[model samples]
Target: MDNRFNFSVPDICDDHADKVQVSNLRLQSFGGNDTFSGPIETINCPDDNSLVKEILNTPGKNRVLVIDAKGVSHASMVGDQIAAKAESNNWNGIVVNGYVRDTEVLKTIPLGIYAIGSIPKKTDKHGLGSIGNDVFVGGILIQSGNWLYIDSNGWVIAKNELKF
Candidate 1:
């Protein structure tokens, strides 16, 4: 899957400011692929990553998972194992509102990963979460099926697909 986008967030915003919502959170990129854009798939889970694991297990071509971890600062919502699975499953990227773990291994994955920070603690596996829902992250309302553009500059979302 060719997940690369030629345009940067600033350029996209400049061209489509009225159509895009820029993320306010300062996200750190951890995956190997720095630029990725695709339709959004959202997960709302506060401190549990069970649904995240399940979602990564499925095929993820041309899609990016937007996880709303409810800004949990302690527990890590994603780690190396889940990220590896996402890469293997052909996921373009993952945007986590909270924290991630295994920062070293995360950088090796081919998928794009943007997170608020890193944590050593893993999340609970109680399988408590909802998928395919509207999730608010970084002061923006990211809904399932919305288009997401991400790069070193920042993250942006559009209601419909846009071409550069």
Candidate 2:
């Protein structure tokens, strides 16, 4: 595999399209961990937890989960259970534009999980939402097929994978 876009790990998306393409006001990379890359899988929902199960059950070998958490400041979209599931399922990483819980446990998992912040609150198990669809986050348009690169520096997206 050529891994065309396999350039230097630290790169920036200079292309601007109206929206800024990042929204979680306080969530930041756990540290300088450059642990996520690859195609995007989006989830745009509120109070829905079924998709979390679906994605966890599926194979995420090298895929990144791009979650549109609707900026739920009061609740956490994921926690220890979800993170453990993702790790067991081989998910490369999870990027949530919302809150998450069990921060201490998450730091121990091998999987990469990025979120807006950690809250003790949890979400409703409505099992309601759509997967593998288009979503607008970070002030940018992000579809299922788009490529996303996430690291401690922040996240950058593009219609197609960018090559160096």
Candidate 3:
């Protein structure tokens, strides 16, 4: 599980121009690994990360968690513990549509974490959130099982897996 995904977003786009959806959001990278690719898994955790923790605890071999925090920054939905679990369970990466805490530890984990920003506050853990739901980020609709390619240049969404 050592950054198993290896591919370039720009190269993939050039080859699959008609099959990709590029995101406009400029999310910051906090994890050690900068690039990753995997099948998508959606979550809706607006102001709460209970379900986020739940999902990361499960097996995540070659999958990415796409969290829809309703584009909010007041409450952090993903932090070190949750992200650590993700890396431990072999998750390729995480794309949070909200903020994340533990900026320091997050940068050390060997997982890909792209977030809007970082905060110091954690979620209330009210167990509020939905799983396997479709999420919208950067005006692009991302559904479960969709392929995602993320790198330093940017992230790209494809309806299906593309050959690198």
Best by lDDT: 1
Q: Clashing residue pairs in candidate 3, if any? A: none
Q: Compared with the true structure, what per-residue lDDT tens digits does model 1 show for residues 30-52?
A: 88888989989999999899999
- Candidate 1 vs candidate 3: the lDDT winner is 1
The candidate with the higher TM-score, 2 or 3, is 3
Cα miss at 135, model 1 (Å)?
Answer: 0.9
Q: In model 3, which runs have C-alpha deviations exceeding 4 angstroms?
A: 1-4
Tens-digit lDDT track of model 2 for 1-164:
44422433344445443222543333565312345667788888766666876787788767778888887778887888888888788677788877788887788887778887878978888878888778777677788877676666666776666654
Q: Which regions of candidate 2 deviate over 4 angstroms?
A: 1-26, 30-34
Candidates in order have lDDT scores of 0.91, 0.70, 0.90
Better model by TM-score: candidate 1 vs candidate 3: 1
The regions of model 1 sitting more than 4 angstroms off are: 1-3
Let me know the TM-score candidate 1 reaches against the reference structure: 0.96
Number of colliding residue pairs in each model: 0, 3, 0
